[model samples]
Target: MSDPDADDREGSVPEAATPKKKKPKKKRAAEPSAGGVAIRAVRLSRWYGKVTAVSEVSLHLGPGIWGLLGPNGSGKTTFMRMIAGQIKPSKGELTVCGEAPFANPNVLARIGFCPQEDSLYDELTGLEFVSAMAELSGYDRVSAERRARAALEEFGLEDAMTRKMGGYSRGMRQRAKLAQTVVHDPDVLLLDEPLTGTDPSSRHQILDALQRRATAGALVLFSTHVLPEVETLTDQLLLIARGQVVAQGGMDEIRQLLDEHPHHIRVQCERPRELASRLMTAEGGIVGLSFRGPDVLEVHTWQPDETYAAIGRQVLESGMKLRSITSPDANLEALFHYLVQRANRGSGMGADAGTGAGPRLQSAAEKAAYEAQLDVGGGR
Candidate 1:
């Protein structure tokens, strides 16, 4: 489906003025923190016979929230399965809590995983099933019961805890699944689309719980194709494409990858006219300069880093102090969308595959499905 917030292409690219820099080699994922790495994948690769699902993905996750972002069929699930021990990597190593995760009970206790697929028995009540899982995690019966109650309460599922899994609404069932995952108080939480098929209130509740876990020092990783969800939950990002780690880092690092990128920076100063004229001649990377308003100039630059530094230097040299300078174009969504478009083009994955599938335009049925997911406050 075409995103309503898709970029407006009309007069988007600014005229080039400053020379672009020699792009740096993409940085590899960093080593885990000393507090201890929650999960690690080294040269990890997986394949389904002749088709490779994930390829040479190496990442070390530290304590905090990280969003696994990608379009559908971007090898996100395969990579997560490898980390969770549900599926073994065809090559290389993946470890959770410094040990191989596959069938390792000790390592498993450190993890709380909520897969996209439901795995609850129809006859069992939410409370009974989760309490049982908590018990199996090695908690005593009393402790398990208490933990289940607390988790259910946090998810606002206390009232429905006794409801049979078969009769629960999709939103209620999702809450139950989330409660079960956290029942054992695992150190690392891997949630795959945990907010899918929920009302706005439920989605907000789940996001609160996830944020609480991250604040409590757990490594919380969740996957979602929804751009706004990622923007809201975490700025720490792991952007994957076609089974490869295309870009992985904080927001600023990701933005640096866009070549010949021009961004509009709003500058408020004592002398706007003087600032614009001075910026026009500055060397490192000045693309364009225009008056945004009475006391602000919107400067466009190819090398933001260099131009920003140069602007500071000019201010000092001229002994002029500006009130404010902000880059409105340097945002997470724009950078992410640019990267995805570039990846799609480089991979030659059919021009219309990401949003439009064929020349027949969007059908009402597909738009209805998209709107339905949105109305439910779910970004699946």
Candidate 2:
């Protein structure tokens, strides 16, 4: 991805112009009780001339790790920037730490922002770059260097600390960026795709560090389109699509909201026609059914549990051979597609017709299934 702040980094802010030290950091308010709100947005919107990057959206988040999920150009970045106080909202209100973030130095100081794009000073070594950011966060020179080293070590970037960012690979640069974001130990961290391009070890370290921060009462919000990545970190998610908030809550909560939609399941069997015929005649939950090929059947049902039980009974009674059963809409990617399609349909925008927008999901199970099919067909 191209760096979004490339131009701003070239015209760097002078050290002397950085915000001066304020009063000793105030003790943060007590952590909210269950269901408390840490960040609140009321009809928030952002626009650049005629382009509306974020539509009116309202949300309430508590202190915890949250996955901000959306597709490319879905306004996740724009919304994060607005909350970080990097840009003013064009409409409505957004508050962090109980105060509007725009131009609020006190609030900004308590907020750590890790942007999606590379915003490093290539000429500076990793340690120096992070130390600079810590200093800008109001830490003195000695404390800044100490914190910088600690943060780099936390992200397993100690070996690369002395290397100039210009010489760092993509993964190394990503870790360096993450290290700086948490160097000052802010109360709220807005991380934009902080794990992108990182190796498995680096990803583990980064997630562990974020988990520690959340345990200490810091609200960590990280954005990514990868479903498995989100599953690894947190259950609380804020899903956005087409510049709007589509849904928010745990996986189960979101799924409950989607209970009205029929679930699509794909089945492969030795006698698909017989299985389909028996299922269609025996089931009450089956809403739709079709044959994909001679040995494959696609079934849509509103009550999946009941339908599956029925399928098992039918197979046992008829002595039919069964191969495998898979639900295509059982993962986050499918939920996202269902919500986006619903949103589009509600707005009179034909779901898959007007906007070329649809859910893109490639889960581990899906990939394995595809590979198995390839092997069976002698194409592997």
Candidate 3:
């Protein structure tokens, strides 16, 4: 994927950028310049032995809710962990707020990370856990308590703030984890699957809180495999497949990218043969048509809106009874698969090639997310 402000890094170069330009004597922090990039990466990669997890990913991300989208083992978690300074990149340069994050306490302080594995202390109350996080981020005891409660309220966990996390439900526990991540009000937030076990109400509240933080000038980036989750959070996206970026930008750009694929409209009508015949005489809007059954017509068209409009007019003018209409390939799963299939790879979206779940799910949440994207009556 090529970002507006980032250099193209699809191919291997002569040399990768070196890290550690300066040594830190203390936990000193730094912020990006006015109107500067919040996070930047160049040829960033991570590997284990001979297997590369993230490969040559370069991005220029500013303040917004940027969703890191990919399938199982697409390296979303590894890429995020590198940014949070939990793991060092094997190659390339990564900076958060104009400073290196790896082993740098100051830069790490400006970043909040909510890991996918939410391992909490069963004995501690939600408020106590969040307040401890705040204090660890340099807040005093009194201030930590105040900020912790406020953060909990922001995530709609005010009623359960005093309860022990072990006794809390899955949704409540996720919210508490999010509260601690934002308790210090870090400039960059790296959340991994924050909505895995959330209900619809909790999902709405969590998305609203993230939007508020983005509007307040904080860069909130989260990772998720679910399409609806990202769509509900923000339009800005960084799509990756097989450890490489396949697409970036808003929904419109992604839709436009797969224009070559015909938009399929499945319609059930009283006279399918007559409808197909009528559409055959129209202009260049339709590409082809086939009969699914005696009363069903499946249309392939380049322009769905125009073709559907024409179909509607033909039905109304000819007094044809139309039972139902639906687009089978208009959802996010189709779009994502299209982009992944179109990605510059030599093999299928399977195994190391990315996006397929033939072998590599590291956690139960990943398996669940992958299963959620699967169609009930169709194959990918």
Query: Residue-wise lDDT of candidate 3 within 213-302, one digit each (tens)?
Result: 788778888988778877777777777777776655565555665566788899999998998898899864899999998999999999
Q: Go through the candidates in order and give each one's C-alpha lDDT.
A: 0.71, 0.76, 0.75
Error of 3 at 160 (Å): 3.1
Candidate 2 displacement at residue 265 in angstroms:
2.6
Top-TM-score candidate index: 2
Q: Which lDDT value does model 2 have at 337?
A: 78
Residues 8-99, model 2: lDDT tens digits: 24754235334432332542332334222267775578989988778766666767898988778778999999999999999977888888
Q: Looking at candidate 2, what is the lDDT of residue 192?
A: 97
* lDDT (C-alpha) at residue 362 in model 2: 50
Off by more than 4 A, model 3:
1-37, 290-296, 303-317, 322-330, 341-380
Task: Name the 10 consecutive residues with the lowest summed lDDT in model 3.
Answer: 12-21
For candidate 3, give the lDDT.
Answer: 0.75
| Model 1: per-residue Cα lDDT over 1-380, one tens digit each | 34211221242212221121122243221223323546766557899999877876656676778888877888889888877889988996778778888887767777888888866788999889889988787655665676787788888888889888888888888889899889876778899889888888998899988888788778888988666777788877877777766666666655664454576678888887877777778885777888878888888888777888888887777777799999876666666666677676774232122221122225777544433332111111
Off by over 4 Å in 1: 1-37, 257-261, 264-300, 305-329, 347-380
